[model samples]
Every structure is written in C-alpha cells, then in structure tokens.
Target: MPCRKERDERRSYGGGNQAQQYYQQSQGAGGQKPPPQAPPPQNGAGMEGKFDDVKPKFNDVIFALLFLAQLGAFIAISVISLRALPASEGSVGLGQSGGTATTLNASTAWLLAIISGTALVLSILLLVLVRLFTKIILELCLLLAVAMSIGYAVYMWVERYWSGAIIFTIFAVISILAYPGMRRRIPFSKALLLFVIRVAKFHPSVYVIALIGTTLTAAYSAYWAISVVAIYQKWSPNAEGASTSGGTPSSGAVIGLMVFAVFNLYYTTQFLTNLFLTTEAGIFGAFYYGGRDAKKVAWGAFKRASTYSFGSIAFGSLLVALLDLLRAFFQILQSYESGQGDIIGAAVACVAQCCVGCIAWAVEYLNRYAYIEISLYGKAYIPAAKDTWNLLRDRGITALINDCLVGNIWTFGSYAVGGLSSLFAFVTVKASNPSYIQGNSGLVACITFYAFAIGFFICHSLGYAGLSSGVSTVFVALAHDPEVLAERDPQLFETIRRTYPHVLNPV
Candidate 1:
C-alpha cells in the first residue's frame, strides 16, 4: 500500500510539470513575447549601432549653372535697353519747318545711358539677391525699369521715331517673362503672382473698373488741357506766335508737357481713388470690428482719418491757389515783354479771374471741412447770428462764442497766408517784367508746374499719414476692452498683454 501511494504522488507531479510546459508553449504561439530588455553595453566602446545614411539627389554645380543662366538673361536685356536711343530726326535746322528737331545734349544722353546701365546691373544683382534674401526688391526694380522704358518710349514718340517704341516693347516683354523667374526665387512673389493671375482670370470686372477710371481720368485731363490752351490763346496771341516760331511747339517741350500732364492726371486719379478706397476700407475695417463689438474704436479711427484727410486737402488747395496766382503774374510779365498788349491785359484779367476762383475754392474747402467736422462731432454753434444775439443780450454764451471764434482763427489764418503769398507772387512778376509782362509767361508755366508737384507730394504724404494714424488707432483700441479682446481672440489678447502692455496702458 506504501509503494502504490508513492507512485500516485510521482504521477501527479509529472502531470503538473507537463501542464506548465504546455502553458509556456501556448503563450509563445499567441505572440505574447516578454517585455524587451535593453541591449548590454559594449565593453568601453561608445556605440555599436550604424550611423544614419543619406543620399544626394541633386548636384550643387547644376544649381549654380541655372543661376548663372538666369542672371545672364537679365543682364543681356538690360544691356539692350541701355545702348538703344530714340531715332534721330530726319529733318535738320532750328526753326526750319517739318518735324520737330531733337537736340540730345551730352548730359541728357549720359543720364539715359546711366539709368539703363544701372537698371541692368541692379536687375542681375537682384536675381542673385533674390535667391539669397527672397524679397520683392527685384520685382520693384523691374517695375522701375518698365517705367523708365515707358518714359523713353514717350521721348521717342515726341521725336516721331519708332526706335524707342520697338525697344520699349521688347523690354516690356522681357520684364513680363522675368517676372515668372522672379516668382520662382521668392515664395511671397509666387503668392503675389498667383493672386494677380487669379484676379485677371477670375475677376475680369476689375479690368473694367480700371478701364473706366482711366478713361474718366483721361477725359478730365483733356478738358483741363483744352481749357488752359484756350485761355493761353485768348490772353497771349503773341506768345502763341512765338510758340509757333519753330513751326510747332518744340516737340521736346510739348512731349515733356504731355508727359507731365499724363502723370499729373494719373496721380490725381490715384489720389481721389485712394481717398475713396481708404474710406471704404476704413468703413469695412470698422464694420468688421463693430461686428466684434468694437464700435467705439472704429468711430475713433474714422474721425481721425477724416480730420487728417480734410486738413491735407484744405492745405493743398490753398497752396495751389497761391501758386497759381504767382504763375499768372509771371505769364502777364512774359506777355508784356513779348510786345503783346492784348495778351498782357488778358493775362492780368486771367489773374484777376484766378484770384476770384481761388477765393471761392478756399471757401469751399473750409465749408467742406466744417461740414465733415460737424457731421462727425455734432454741431453746437452758429457764428454771425449767435454773436449778434449774445452781444445784445450779454448772456453767458460768451465762453461758447469764444471757443467757436478761436477754433476758426487758425483756419482763417491759413487762408490769409495763402492770399498774401499769391499777392506777393503777383506783385513780384509784375515788378520784374513791367516792360514786357508777356515774356514772363514761361515763368508762370514753370511756377505752375512747381506748385502742382508740391501740392501732389504734400497730398500723397498726408494720405500715408492718414493710413498710419488709422491703423495705429484701430490697433490701440483693439488692445483695450477685455471683453472685446476675449470674444475676438483670447490668445491674441494674451499675446498683446504680454508683448505690448504699455501700449494698452499708456500714461
């Protein structure tokens, strides 16, 4: 009985061991591997694994060759433009009939040559620079080249030659093609190119708008030119005769004037369009802000923008009017010296007319500014009527009257300065050319040009000022108002608080 019991115990132990072995095999078959153990460290060696391998797909040499090829193309086009000039006139002799003669002095030719050369060198440099810096400088340079070429073409047209036209066309084509190359060098250029392309392709209406604006601008310029010419003819018949001494207005002078006129028209249209667009853009910006509960900010920005714009226009209009009076004075002097009595008297009359016109214009500008301010700030004062009643009654309206009176003094002072300046110019021209006032007509034209240019420049600068003020005001207002900030963008609010805390809390 003891032996049999021992055998049973042995059988049970063997069976238990067999069951454990089966369980291990089953675990392996079911993919239940043991947790991975780290590899053992090598004996005093840093690493045993292989280093990462990389393969070269492109050669640096090929890239260098491509860059050189592109640079060569740009340089070649620039060289062509620089060497070419407007064709020489077929007719010779000063003041002897036929086509207007072109007298290209050494200085003028040298300047043109230099411009062309610089454009070429810069274009090539820009190509390389673009590869490195990836900015729009190259594109801007190209645009400048195009503008220069256009100017050269106009010069040719005035000379009645085809050489300039042909050269301009060729350069224009090159610029267009090079634009794509420019895009490839810069990411933003590519994006801008795509945007313009998309606009051309999808929004043909934009072209129509541009065409309409251009047409209107041209018509306005034509009307202005005709009016000026008619006035000149009516005032100074002798000056007209002098202009025809060379059998036509000097082609160069005429071309120069036309170019000046065209540029003036373009700038004027651009100015008006910008003013309109700014207001629209501001309104849109404000509306967007208001939608986010930023109405006060928008209104503030609008007020500032309107004030600056109106102020600039008022100042420019006054300045131009003053300059015009000076110009008229010079014209009368020129006419008198040229032995043109009818023209002298006529020029004097025109000066008188201009003075009247300027006064009206000044009043209009002031009224416009006043209207805008009143509409924006709300009206609370009357001038003459209120003063008479207040003076008669001896009421406490004195402070209010004083404020209104003081507010307009500076504006009236500006008008007074303008008038005085005009008077000075008129007297100066009359004094200088007492014998032949007609001879000073040329001086008048020159002064007029200067005045127009100055006014435009001032107006342009003011537009920029307006834009900057508007942007700053909007950003500042956005920085404040925690609720608005939170609703618009919590992240942006935090960023503003972190980066520009002082801007938000200005002392």
Candidate 2:
C-alpha cells in the first residue's frame, strides 16, 4: 500500500490539483513510467496463499434452504398452470378470447425464441467488440450520449417545446464542457477494461458461464411468460369461453397466483445474476492475487459460488428481489390510480415506487462489492456486506468515478443492442404477420418492448456482469492487499500508477 503520508498530502490538495500534483510526482524528473518496485511482503499467508489456507464452509444455510423451497414451489405452480393452458388454434390476442386462445400461443412462443436467439448473438458480439476495440468503443459511447442530448434539444426547439429544449440544451452544454475531464480518465478506464477482457479470455470458463447464464435466463423468461399466460387463461374472469372447464373464474385466485409468479420471477433472476457475478468475482480475485492455475481458479470459483457461498448469494439476492417486487407493485398501483383519476393516490404510489427503486439500486450496488468479498474470503453475507461498506466508504470516490465512466460504456452498449433487437422484432412480426400481432399496434409494441428488455438483460448478464465483476474484484483486492498486486505484477501496478497516481496511495 502507498504511504499514509502521501495520502495525507493528496487530501491536503484539492480535487484536480491532487491528481495533477500526483501525476507530476509520478512522472519524476525523467518524465517516464515509474520504475517497477515490489512492496515488502507482510507476515502470515500471502494474498494468494490464503486461498489454500482457508477452508470453505457453507454460509447462510437457512437462506439456501429457503431459496430451494421457493424454487420447488414455483416449479410446482408452473407445472400445474401450464397443464391448464387452453388448446389453441391460430387466434391469439389480449383481452377476452370468447372461445379463442387469448393468452400467448405458439406464434408468441416462436417470437420469444427468435428474440432470445438474437439477444444471445448480439450479446456475444458486444463482448467481442468491447474486447477488440475497448478505447474506440468507450469514446464512441461518450460521444453518442452527448450527441443524442444535443440532437434531442434541437428537436425540442423545432417542435416549440421551450421547457424540453432548455433542459436538454443545458444537459448538452454541461456534458460537452465536462468532456475534457472525462476524457482524461479514459486511458486508465481502458486499461482496466482490457485487463478484465484478457482475464476472461485467459479463463474461457468465464465465457462459458456467461453463455449458460444467458441461455437459462432467456429460457426462464419464456417459461415465466407461459406460466402467466396459463394462469390468466384458466383463472381470469374473461376466460369463461376460452377453456372447456365450467368452473367460475376466481379473481382472487388469479391475483394471488400472478403475485406469486411475479415474485418468483424477480427472485430467480436476481439469484442467477448474483450467482454468476459471485463466480466471476472469484475468478478475477484469483487472477489478481496470482499463484493459482487459471483453470483451477475458475473451476474452484464456480464450485464455491454454486455450493458453499450459494446461500450468501441467495440472501443478498432476496433483498434486491423483494425491493423490486415492491417497486413493481407500486408501479402497478400508480397506473391503476392514474387510470381512475385519483391524482393524489397516483402521486403517492409514484413516489413510493421511486423510493423502492432507489433502495433496490443501492442494495444492488452494495451486493456487487459484498459478493466480491464472499468470493475472495468465503465469508457470509452479513460480514461481507459490512466489509464491503467499509471499503466503499474509505475508497468510494475513485471507485464511483471509475464505475460511472465504465458503466456508461456498458449502459450505452446494452441500449444499442436492445434497440437493434427491438427493430428486428418489429420487422420479423411485420413480415410474418403473426395472428396475435397483426392489426394490433398494442401487441406489436408489447413484443418490441419484450425484445428490448430481453436483449438488454442478456447483454448485461453476459458482457457487463463479467467485466464489472473484474473491476469490482480488482478494487476489493487492492483495498484488502495492495501489496499483492505490487508484488505479483509490478508492471501492471506501474501502468495503473501512471494513469491514476492516487491509486498508489492508500485511500
């Protein structure tokens, strides 16, 4: 770790000045990369050696058991609901079927399959592009964000929407003015991204895991959709003529089943997402500390994530899942209140929705670092969360700025892929003229939305998650033991020091 004295000096100076002074100091009189030098080894096990010393044990066993029970319940519900799906002909549309299939049918199923396939391909391509052209891609994403703000401002002006125009104009100006400072961070960001890419490439299991995650999420999404459709077909009040059974439609039962399905959907997705992130974090942590074979490290990480630490992942995931479920519920309430012209009720619901969403975001952010701790140290969720919170508080500014910059790259990339997928969905539906989508602009819109969402989800899972895990693991590892990097890979440390001198100093 860099000396506390230097860190105090950095704190003494202001923002950009701190970075600037550190830059000059790093350059020295010769104005070149710092000479490679390893930090002195600490007592006890070396960072890499700890992996062998620590014996893995199951953490948060109760949460793991609960998660399994939930999974079992969801599976049972899905099976029962699916068995109740009405036999279908060509007819498929929303609302009352009146003796026809109203819920999703074979055509919708095919469409989902196609959309999933497209998303998978696009996500893989996105990873390839980021790896091959990290800097260029990053630059383009930044430029595009600024350009879109300017363009939107211009359009708003043309349409005589003064408020819209002014707001966008201000945003455009601020982004443009801030470009220089943002641009300066790109080199370091690019280096970090490239390192992560190289790590993923070195251990191909990372990609394999990503592939499995993408496929499972997409398939599960389809299954969830089918389950919802089946529930509506069998239990909805409007389904009287759609099914052969003459049982009266029970609205209460329908709502209960729907809620259960929705909750499980959120939980399952969150669980899988955290699982993959935890696995990747382990791989990156191993690479950072060195001394372990890449293959062994990767396999070991996956095993730990899927077994011993599974409950920790599940526990963290449950927090986010519950928040999301509440957010969704509030959103639905807001919509209902708005439709009923209950202005105050709608406003309250909207506010509640926003609050829940923000909380979910915060929890998810904490989970990112907590999972890193779990992956590296085999700690339970509470301990991992506590340590992660402490680390963030101590070194958050650097991590925040770095995350914001890199996040923009992936966010824009995912949006681009999603937009393309939506376009593909639109064109495909139009060309095929599916009975459900034909003549129904609403259905068309819904399908396109699903495509966009699935594309974004898949891209985030396969590309962003892997890379982001690498970045988070690096930060966590550095915070815990900077000496490890300095000892194992002095050259990389020097490169990091060149771009961000503050990194050398303890935060």
Candidate 3:
C-alpha cells in the first residue's frame, strides 16, 4: 500500500495545475472539449483542421524490425496456406457453395492437424513468454500481429470488388498525405533501443496486462462458441446443418449462423477488448502515478474496469460489434453472389463495402485510445471517449497514430501472422495427406488462423495496450502536472521525450 504521504501526492494529480484545468473542464460536461471554432462558419470556420498546441517528433521506430518479422511470418504462412486451398469448390465455406470435402490421405490430414495444432500451441507459449520475460520478443510478436491485420484488410478490400479497392485506395492516399500535423514515417527498425528501455521499465504492468487479456479472451471465445453453436441448433429445424457434410443447408440456417456469428464475435470481442484494455490502462496508471505493487495495482485496475467503466465499456462494445457486423455482412453477400447471381445481393454488398476501408480502422482506433482515458479518470464511456479524442487532438496523439501508426500497428500484424501460420499448417497437411483432401485444407487453415489469431491477438494486446496507455497517461499526467512524471520517474519522463520529440513541457 502507498503510504499516507503518497496518497496525498496522488490526490494532487487529480488537480492543481494547468494540465488539470482542461481535464477538469472536460469532466464537467460529459468530458466534451469543444475544438476552438469560430461562430461564423460561412466567413471563417468549422472545426480546427490542425492541432494548435501539439508538435510531435518524427522518425519513431519503436518496433520496426519486429514488424518485419511479423510481415515475413504472415507472408510465408499465407503462401503455404494458399496451396492447401483447392482451386475448385473449396472456396465455398464463406461465400461459395458446399461441395465435396477435399480428399486427404490419413497421414496428410494428420500432418496438417499436427502442424496447425503445434503452431497454435507454440504461438500461445511464445506470447506468454514474451509478455513475462522477453520484452523485445513480445514486441516482435505484437508487430507481427499488426502486419497480419493490415494484410487481411487489404485482402478484404481487393478480393471481392476491384472498383471499391481503386476508389478507397485513392481516399487512403489522400487521408494519409492530407492529414495535418503529420510527420515523416520511421524506419521499420526505428527506436528498438528506446522501446526496450520503455518496456524494461514497465514490464511489471505488462505482465498483469498479459494475464488479464489472455484470461478474458479465452473466457469470451469459449462462451461465444458454445452459445453460438447452441443458437445454431435452436434455429435450425434439423441439427445436421451443424455438420459440414455435402448436404444442402437452408438459407435460414446459414443466416442464423451468420447473424449470431457476426454479432457475438463483435459483442464478445468488443467487451473483452474494452475490459482488458481498460485493465491495461489502469495497470499503467497505477505505476505511472503511484509506485507499483503488481497485485495491488492489478486489483485497482479490476475495480475500475468492472465498476467505473462498466457502462461505457458495454455500450462502446456494442457500437464496434454492430459496425463489424456491417463489414462481415457485406462479405457474406459477396460470397454468395457469384453462384446465386443475386444482383440485389451484389448491389447491396457493393454499397455495404464502400466504407470498409475507413470504418474498421476508425472504430478500432477509437475503442483502443478511448478505453485508456475511460480507465484513467473512471469516467463514463462517451465522456471518456470524447476526452480521449480531445486529448489526442490537443496532444498530437492522433497525428502520431495516423502518421506513425505507433500503437495499432501490432494488431494488424497479429491478424496476419495467425493467417500465415495457419497456411503453414495447411501446406504441411496437404503434403502429408496421401489422398490429398482438396477443400479440407482451407477449412483446417481457417481453423488454425482463427485459433492462432485470437490467442495471438489477445497476447499482443497485452504489449500494445499497455504501451499505448503509457503514452496517454504520460501525456495526461504531464498536462495535469508536468512535474508529476519528472518527480515520480524522472528517467521515464526523459525517455518519453526520446520516444516522442514533439512532446512539450506542460508547465
């Protein structure tokens, strides 16, 4: 427990400086910080286009080499998995028709299964070790996750609709180049030494983050799978639709499965994502503001996560879930369109996919940073989200995110790495199968991808979430009281500058 003197000091962090002035004002009215807008829009204004206060440093390379490893893992895995996928009706699972299962020799089937199963096990163990022991290795894995996520996004974009891809590609370029206060990109290997220092200094918080995120992910995934399966059987008149045998399934069965699958994934993912993310932030908050006792800090994080941020976390999760459902629904439509020739489905799918490029990225970005503030102040969701956005804008964190892709990069890598790793298993299975099952490889690959992806994602979240929160906490702490960071951990305070040159003294 912190001594009385420390408690008195922490109280001061709540207020008593220029930084807290805005923070104080934000908390009053749902934490809304109105951008400086001139009243007359016709002549002079709307929202501020650029950050007025923040000046961020460029050339941040916190996890560059790690990102490359992630990229290679994803690419190699994806290429190998591609061979497991048969060129014919094997594509039917998500969009295509269900035909014959791919024939694979017993040995081949065993090989693929063993390969994927091993990858899954190793990935989990690797993530755990990275979190608890090897900080650099953990980051490398995290960056791999980010690379995968980005790859998946790209694949989704160009896979179904070329036109959509072309148009969005233009928008993406414009968004990147035109965004104000943007900085130059860093080397893929930038800032390893600096990031290593940061990680070492805060590994205790990282450990708690890893454990909490992993537990929540496992719990949610199990709950989602069991409930979704039961719901599938409940809605389907015949339970045989549960089996992927060559039998035809009613559209209703597929729809039931799809609806539940989409919503529940989003629901569970959002909830766990928020819950763990908030915990990650709180853990960092305890350490950055108060000195660390891993268990006590973790407990404090738990209280705030369950009690204070409960409402916001639930509601915010719903929004992300719905948005994801929208994205997934479009993909499903596109899948069925080729064979069904449902022009209406095609049209609607096209419309649905129009915003695919931006919406997912934006929603993800908001959920992540918003949770940090939500955990920090014990504020409600909307206020916390608004305050977080305002703080990012005011502090140049948004620019850092947009230009640097510092925090969210690992998520993309994790998604891709899992897919690629699944692919690796898929190829190995095909080579081992004497009969060479055609379609089954894709199914196995998909399983491997999801299993590895989900677990790896949660693991990477441990690293990424804490690090991002650390940045946010430091920014807020500095703003509220510049000396707080310097006084509490002067080494960390200086290290922050090396990591982000744009940071200004709050005083």
Candidate 4:
C-alpha cells in the first residue's frame, strides 16, 4: 500500500491533470489520437508488489454464509410486511383493504390478465414475428413499433403511464434491442453483470458496506418522518376543526409543500450517503480486483469520497433529489382532480415530466462516469465530470452508454427485484394471517406495505449501486489505464479490445 505521502503524490499526478497533459503531448491541439504510451503504474513501480502481498483475505464459504445473513436481514422486514397485507379472498373487499398497492385499472387489469395467461406462448409468437421481419425500415422500425405499441398499451393499461414521459425507461428494453449502439451492448452487459456478481461472491464485505448505508439512510428517514408529524401538528394545532382555509392556502397544502421540501432534503441526504458508501464498494472492487493497493483501498476510498470529492457527491445528489422532488409533486398533481383546468394540468404534467427526465439523465450520466473517475483518479467533482465526458465523447462511449442502456437495465432490474420481493411479502401475509387481514386491516396493511416498500427500496438501492458503479468503473478504468487493464486480467483486456474496439482502441 502507498503511504500517506506517496498517496498524496499519486493524487497530484492522477486523473484529469494527467489525462490533459498526456492527451496534449500525444494527440496535439487537434487531439486526434490516444496516447501511445501505456499508462504509468497507478501508484508507481513497487506498488503492484505491495498489492500482491495484500491477498483477497476473504474465506469464500464463511463469507458466503455471512453475506446470506446480511441480505436476509435486509429482506426480513419486507417479507413480514407482505405477510401482513390484506390478501385474503374477501378480506373486507380486496380493492379497499389491500392498502395502496399499484393495482391495474379496470381495462389494464383485463389486458394484463389476458397477456399473462398467454405469457409462455407469447414468447414464441413474438420471436417468430421478430424473425419474420427482414427489412430494416419495415421489421426493426415499423414492425417493431407496432409490436412495441401493443406491449406499451398493455403496460399503460396496468401501470397508468403518460405518453413520451420517459422514453428512456418506458421503452428501455425494446430500445436496447432496436437501437444499434445499445444492441452492441448486449454482450458487454452480460460481462458486466458477471463481473459484479463475482465481486460480490468473493468479497462478501461489500454486502456489509451496502447494509450500513441502507441502515443509516433508513434511520434518517425515520427521524424525518417523526419531524413531519410535528410540522403537521404545528400547522393544524386544532386538529379536529382545522379544515377552514383562513384567506390563504389550506393547512394540507402547506403541509404538502413542507413535506416536499423534507423529501428533497431526505433524498439529497440519501444519495450523498449512498455515494460515499457505494463509492467505497467501487474503490474496494477497483483496487482489490484491479491489482492495486488492495489492502488500503477502503481507507483510500474514504479519504477520496468523504473528503476531496464531497462536493461532487453533493452536486450530483442534488440533481437526483431535484428529480425526486419534481416526480413527487407530479404525483401530487395526478392525484388531485383537474376539472376545467384539465388541459392546463395536462400541459403542465408534460412539462414537469420533461424536466424530470432531463435532470434524471444528467444525474445518471454524471454519477456513472464521475464517481468512477473520482474513485480511481481522486479528481474533484466538476473536473472529473467534465474530463470524463470528454473522454467518453472522444471515444464514442457516450453514444454507447445512451444506446446500450446498461445503466437503465441495472436500475429496472433492481426495481423488478424489489417488486417481486414485495409481492412475496404481500403473499406471505395473505397466506399466514388470514384473520388479521380481515376488517379494519386497511390502515395496518397500508402502514405495513409502506414500511416494507421503503425498506426494500433502500436495501435494493444500496446493493445495486455497487454493481452499477462497478460496471462503469471497469470500462472507464479499461480506457484510462490500459496497462493496468492488461496486467490485471489479460482475458478481460482482450474482451474489451475485441468487443468495444471503438472505445478501447484509439482512432
């Protein structure tokens, strides 16, 4: 491991500074080519030997059991919530007592039922339909659009979606298949997933780190929940007869605004906390797996994430929080009836959602690249973000990330896991506690489901962040330091060079 002084020296010559100087000298003012020289060793010549001495130090079998226990703890609350929901055949009207589940609308429900009934057969039909198309404009474009419309219609029926609100997420899976850049990412996505699982499987401590972040975020959330109640009480001191609006906005409206502010603060805090936590995981994975100062990776990640790069963490997190806040307000609008202003509300909804998408894309793009650079290179947030963008743009990796959809894949995949786990939770309660799920179970189920979902989401977010960040880090590291890439894993280096020649090889 590099000593403190040596580490400082490494930072002085690392990341954007080195990248700029190297690119300038090698590529000239035109900057038309990658540097011919292999990147110097990350922490000087003797560091690799020190890294070698730092063995993995994890007992696979023992750590596997420990990891299981850690993950089980995270899911236990979710399961208990599911088991407590009103799932009985006629538990005081399933619709009314089932809590706030995202059930299908009447038309959507019927459509989903029909499609779900033929799920096994639909695969074959869809595959045949896809194979039948031979023309680019006809098959991939026209025919695919028709097929996607059908699928989207089904989703809209059940999910209550607005058109064009989220082009990235709504048609994300299909987009990956249809778009050429994303289509190329099919293989890299698998490779990235495998690499992430290997990291989790071997270095079980990663789970502990994830759990810690999730726990702290939950704690702060609980504290905020309590604070919200106090805020509401102050707004309506005379709770029983406070419905009157005293020549101003109703107390509920004020409370809602306050709650939105609290939510923004909460989300900002959550991401910053998570950025540090998952950045720790990214750092550990990068060094331990990348064959660098493995033993000191944890400490190094902390000094870099918590100290030097805190500003980046805050700024990126704020963008994420802004999106969350906007989405929450949008949901509020959707809930309230729009009456004569329906057209105005619809227009506002479209604009609000567009803003949400822009912020979401920015945060996603920044964090995916910037966090990796921050961990590996120890650059400040803005500098890291800017330089990273230039690197990806110059290498055409920017287009790849957009079309490839790996980031969205991981995100939606995590949500799927959370949904399934929540479903299991609902089922468990319905099966085991038939009597409790009867009359007056609405509030109980609602509270239980809310807690369950919150816990499930936090746990899932923490667990998934490392994997997502790891994938980006691996690719960025591969591009930034080919020498380390080739030395650490020649097989992976060859795979990158072969699979993404546009990204790995200089023009």
Task: Give the TM-scores of the predictions, in the order they appear.
Answer: 0.27, 0.80, 0.59, 0.56
Q: State each model's C-alpha RMSD to the native.
A: 30.4, 8.8, 14.4, 14.1
The 10 consecutive residues of candidate 4 with the worst lDDT sum are: 50-59
Candidate 4 C-alpha lDDT tens digits along 318-390: 5566677777677567545354467678678767877787878677666667767665555555666786777
lDDT of 3 by residue, 258-277 (tens): 47565655666567666766
Error of 1 at 418 (Å): 30
Q: By the TM-score metric, which is better: model 1 or model 2?
A: 2
Output the number of the TM-score-best candidate.
Answer: 2
The order by descending TM-score is 2, 3, 4, 1
Model 3 spans with C-alpha error above 4 angstroms: 1-205, 222-254, 292-295, 340-348, 354-357, 402-409, 412-416, 424-456, 466-468, 488-507
Q: Count the backbone clashes (under 3 Å) in each candidate.
A: 18, 0, 37, 7
| Residue 328 of model 3, lDDT score | 77
Q: What overall lDDT goes with each candidate model?
A: 0.33, 0.70, 0.48, 0.45
Better of 1 and 2 by lDDT: 2
Q: Is candidate 2 or candidate 4 better by lDDT?
A: 2
